[model samples]
Target chain A: MRRALGWTVVVLTALVLQSTVFAQIKLGGTKPELVYLVTIVLAFLEGPASGAVAGFGGGMAQDFLLNQPKGITALTLTLLGYGVGLLRQYVVTPSPILPVVLVGASTTVGVLFYGVVRFLLGFNPGALYLIKVAVLAGVYNAILTPLLFPPIRRVAKATRANKVFRW
Target chain B: MALRSRPRNTRLVVISLVMMSLLTITLDYRGGQSGPFEVAGRATVAVVGALQNGVSKVVRPIGAFFSGIAHVASLQSENNKLKRQVADLQRRTAERVSLERENQRLLALAHLEQTLQLHGVTATVIGESVGNFEWSITINRGSSSGVKVDTPVVTGNGLVGHVIEVTPTTSKVQLIIDPSSAVAARLSSSGETGLLTGQRGKDLTMDLISVGAKVFPNEPVVTSGYQGGLYPPDIPVGFVSHVYQAPNDLTKLISVRPAVDFSSLEFVLVVTGGSSG
Candidate 1:
């Protein structure tokens, strides 16, 4: 219960920051997807189930809170959270840069998926523009991963179920 | 058996969540502005917007400080003693400059209001759209302030966008540069009309123009304000940056630079009591 509450607070704070501060600070005409970053990092910290839940909650909050297309973000983030969680279980890399690379790659894929979904909904902005936004947003999110991951990991650890050890 | 069931449960949970998201998307897509999804969205915005308004006020000064730093860093790097003096002077100057700039903008809006005989509520931008897919901003005014959907939002210079969503305390304005936006526009010089549409990260495009219409670069564009239109007539929209005719094309190709600089947009007027037809 505490874990759920903690994660909820994290997601809500991320939503606020994404719409306010990050919205004003655009680099190369793109801002970092702060909620997207938190969702993926949470997925990496928790398992698949927690990841999916975080994704849905975060995405829904973003869509509704920011006047975006209602559920598209929810759909995309749900799948991304689950996939990232599942993928993490199969990979074991000691490289410190793994989080950055994973974040960059996943953000690109998630944004591309979002673009394709928007296109299917008949809001075709253009393929070139979509790719440009996706790529730039990915790089932006990656740059933010280092600053965000440690704190999110700390929250996950603090909220995690206490481990039982047997001697 | 327990281990196998763990993975199964995980997959089951993910599947359920994905299904739930799909259902939401369908409902929201069909629901339009007045649907349950939109109402919930507005409520959420209201709650979050309150928090954001507070944060915006706090962070705005910090943002100004950083921008100020960029201007005076050269003086600071030259010498330590002079650096402190310059920093102090810069801070004071930045505050004065910002206030003056804001005063100028407000004064311009006032002048514009008098010139256009506009009756509207002035609003400050509180937040912006969180996603890259949409070009929109949240203003402090809402339905309570007489800001309704499709109400034209403008700066002192020209048209910015129209209200799309509104709660009691806040509203979202879709900027003219959004890819999905379209405005009914006229070339001020020739009196020829066309449908102006936005391109993502590019200049505005006015199409469906008559081939025989005398078009030229640098022509002023304004709202046509045809019958039952959404914008008031004679509001500046953009200026023709390029005009050309493509082979076998039915209409002239024209690119227009928007009159408003969206990046620096801070204040706008929501034409609440006006004939935007």
Candidate 2:
């Protein structure tokens, strides 16, 4: 319960910032996907199950808050969080750069996946522009990773199971 | 045995979550805009929108500062160009007033409405889309302020977009540059009508011009306001920046530069009522 509550607060705060603060600060014609960044970082700290759950909640919050078509971001972020979490289990690294690299790479793949899903739904924004946004957003999220990941890690640790039955 | 069950349970959780997301997407797609999910989404937007509205007030000045710094180098040249355009427009305004008076007289005699008398609710932009894939903005007005879905939004310069979603306290506007947007427009030069479609990051494209229609660069374009259209008549959309006829094509290919600079949208007028012509 504590873990869920902690992550919920993180996701909600990130959603607010994503829409209000980051939305205004465009870099290379796009803002960093802050919720996407948070999901990946949380997944890295937790395992695949927690990651998928967090992704679903965070994605739904964003989709609803921004009034975007429902479920697209939820679907993308679920797969992304699970994939990153599962991959992290095998690639254990203590380096501080791991979050940056993981976020940059996963954000690129995640956005491309999102573009594909949107294209399938018949909303094509042209291939070149989509690719450009993906790359720039990846770089932007990567730059933000270091700033955000540490705090998320602290929150996760503070909220983890002290006694398994205790809420 | 416990460890084995744990991994299986983890896989089950992931699979279940993925399936749930897929089901949601399917339902939302099939249900269109009137789904149960949309109602709940609107409530969520209202709650989050209130939070966004608060944060925006604090961050807007910072955004403006950064934006000003980014464009500082070109501000002087743009100021000079605007000065020249202002003088030219001042000269033309005198001629335009007389022409407009004559046009009004003719319209009155013919019993036709020349333009929509728009009564608008002014709203300040509070937030924009967080995703890179979409072009949308959120305004500080909604159903309570008489803003509704499909209402036209505009700056003083020209049309910006139309409201796509409205909550109790805020609304979401789908900008004209969004991939899904389409506008019915007519050229001012030859009075030819065509369908204008957005090109994402590029200029708007106007198609279906007849092959025989004379076209020129920089001709003004306005909403056609066809019968039962979404927009009223004569709202400025853009200016034709390029026109060409493809070999053996049936129509001219035209690109229009939007009159409003979407990047700097701060405030807009929402056509609340009385736009009927």
Candidate 3:
């Protein structure tokens, strides 16, 4: 319980900053979705149970903050988190690119699902807009995977003294 | 415990993810019928935002120091943008003063209305939409502030976006730069008209201009004052950033760089409309 709670805290903090100050820091014309990056890391580092739980939680919180339709982020993130957890056993590169690529691919799937749901429900996400956001988010998050991995690993690692930071 | 259990475990994992995601989608479609799990998540976000707000106090001084160093790289663009802002501010101030003088002069003969009131509430940007494709901002006002959907938002400079969603104390503004947002606009300089639509990110596409229209690089844009006039008039939107004209095309595509930096928005004005024309 303590470990799960701790990791959840880290993910939540990263999401907040992802939308606040860090959201403004653009590199190569795209800002990294730190929440999605962190969620992917959580899913991979933890198992499917933890991954889905965290993914749904993170997605709900993020969507709420965004004032977007409820459950949109939750659904999309649950898919990505679970998929990442499953793919964790298959990666061979052992590099940041692997995580980035995986993250980008999954984020694309997630956003596509989200866009379709939105469009069908009358939100009307134009094709031009969808492609731009999905592609750019993938690239940006992929690039930041390396920088994100270490912190995620550190927090996920169990420590006897610092229970709050343990995942 | 056994090889057979491994496949079962995978199935269980996939099933669980699928089930939870489906439930989420259903609840979401029903519009905010949150499960207990989702409630916990929102609380978690609130706490995290609070914690980050505290940590930012520590990070702020360091960030400022680094920003000082970083300012060197951004200095040129910053200087130019600041210069333009200074000029724009001077113009607004002059207009305000002149309007004040005119109001006094007309006080005896006319029943003049006050300057245009805002259509929505004001908000301080607290967050931004994650990802490169979608453009939105989290403001410090929400349902509690009577901020509803599609309320026109603006800044001192020009059109920003409309309100998308609202909570108790915060709301999200979909920037005019997002690919999803479209606003009818007119050129302040040449009076040529166009439809302003969002492009990839932080760039707008002004379309439907006649192929022979004499549009220039720095042609200032404002709201069209048509189509219900969601946005007010004379609000400087952006500059002509790029123009794509191909042979044999009846219309040319012009790209505009918005005046307000959606990426770095800190404060905004929401024009909540309820006034006499």
TM-score of each: 0.89, 0.88, 0.69
Candidate 2 interface RMSD after superposing interface residues:
3.2
Best by TM-score: 1
Q: Which DockQ value does candidate 3 get?
A: 0.33
Most DockQ-accurate candidate: 1
**With candidate 3 superimposed using the best TM-score fit, by how many Å does residue A31's alpha carbon deviate from the native?**
2.2
Instruction: Return the lDDT, model 3, position B25.
Output: 58
Q: State the DockQ of every prediction.
A: 0.58, 0.51, 0.33
lDDT of 3 by residue, A23-136 (tens): 545544556667677778877777555566677777766665543455667767777777787777676576756766777777666677777866765666678767666777
Model 2 docking category: medium
Which structure is stronger by DockQ: 2 or 3? 2
lDDT of 3 by residue, B184-242 (tens): 88877678788999865657899988888888887777777665766666566888888
Better of 1 and 2 by TM-score: 1
Chain B TM-score for each model?
Answer: 0.84, 0.83, 0.68
Enumerate residue pairs that collide in model 1. Answer: none
Which regions in candidate 1 have their CA more than 4 angstroms from the true location? A66-68, A163-167, B64-111, B275-277
- Weakest 10 consecutive residues of candidate 3 chain A by summed lDDT: A158-167
lDDT of 1 at A6: 89
